[model samples]
Target: MDRSAEFGRWKAQSLSKADLSRKGSVDEDAVEVVELLNSREEFFTTSSCAGRILLLDGSTEGSGVQKQHCCWLLVTHKPCARDDVMAALKGATSEAVLKFEPFILHVQCRTLQDAQTLHSVAIDSGFRNSGITVGKRGKTMLAVRSTHGLEVPLTHKGKLMVTEEYIEFLLTIANQKMEENKRRIGRFYNYLQHALKRETISNSHSKIKERNNPLCTHKNRRSQGKAQGPSTTEDNGRELEDGDGLEISAALFLGDD
Candidate 1:
């Protein structure tokens, strides 16, 4: 099948599936980004988390716990409180861990160039670990992530190992990470609005109009063929837009503080 038809079919199938995540909805912190991506022909969010402060109960085997087998005792997407963690710890029967997970997102792009454009945006927004992957079957995906995460064992054999003072200290650090995570998400959103949105618009019928009539009108005092250079071409034998979007991509890989 052609790229547009294939992309349309894949997107339809993917979005039609159920949400298997525990919460069954996008995390509040990531809601804006998810919406923005899905609105574009070039992108869609496959999975995402705004970041979380979590407390879990699980087996303490070999002094470590496996998250897949753990029971979530307390989970908060916002900055957490000491009382909440303390209360959750009271329920641990085996090992309990306190964790601060940084914001993470997986986006499927229509093409490798789309993934790369997104990768650069993620990096500029402080998600330095962001990268792109191209599947064997030709699916292109981008993962936006960072290294700012924390995991600490708070209980062993159902006994609290750290003093209240230490737990308080951990809370401070975790909260700080959550705050930074939010900032990064904000930066990412702003950057996408500037860069991705432009590219998304170019993929519209304007791309066809521009292709058929690259030098028709004169606006801004002397420009006709310049219109041809406005889109960032995406697919082959397939679909999508040109010049300014291309200029933006070339001049950038840019964003906020």
Candidate 2:
């Protein structure tokens, strides 16, 4: 099937399927972004997580432990309370680890351009680890993610490996990551809305301008902005950088996957 047809079929079937994530449905923090993307004709979300602070076991034994094999001692999308986490840790049968996983989203785009556009929004919004993967089956997926995650072993073989003071210290870091994750998600959603609207408005404006004045050319349009160009992008030749004010290398490809 053609890419568009394939994407359409996949989207329809996927959206109709039951929520398969561990939490059953989309997290409250991620619902808006997922709905926003699904509302767009060019994109649909496959899966998403708002971000979470996790306490799990069975993962400390292996280098790449699958989540399914691990026992989720505790999982919270919001900042975890010390008492709640301490209570959850009591059920730990083996090693227990505390972790903070940042927000992640998987979006299927109708075209490569759509994926790239979404990728830019993610990168600019501080999900620096975001990436695009084009499958052999003509599926273009963009994963919005970041590397600001934390994992620390709190217990070993059902025995406390660290002092309560240390656990509290760890929670402080994890909670900070959770707060930062919230900020990034907010930025991503806000920027994505603006970007999509800008694209549509720019396209419509170009068509209307051409239809209204067929003789108007690119040079004519360029001269029209010359008077107020100081505040426009035309004067920010060297000021443009990554959204986070970091020096983004031109050669940097937005992919860590």
> What local distance difference test score does each model get?
0.78, 0.78
lDDT of 1 by residue, 23-94 (tens): 999998899999988988878888999999999888755544533467989999987778888888889988
Candidate 2 weakest ten by summed lDDT: 248-257
Candidate 1: what lDDT?
A: 0.78
Off by over 4 Å in 1: 60-68, 198-257
Residues forming the 10-long window of minimal summed lDDT in candidate 1: 242-251
Compared with the true structure, what per-residue lDDT tens digits does model 2 show for residues 94-135?
A: 888888999999999998767766877787677888888999
lDDT of 2 at 229: 18
TM-score of each: 0.78, 0.78
Report RMSD (Å) for each prediction in the order shown: 8.8, 7.0
Highest TM-score model number: 2
Candidate 2, residue 95: CA error in Å?
Answer: 1.6
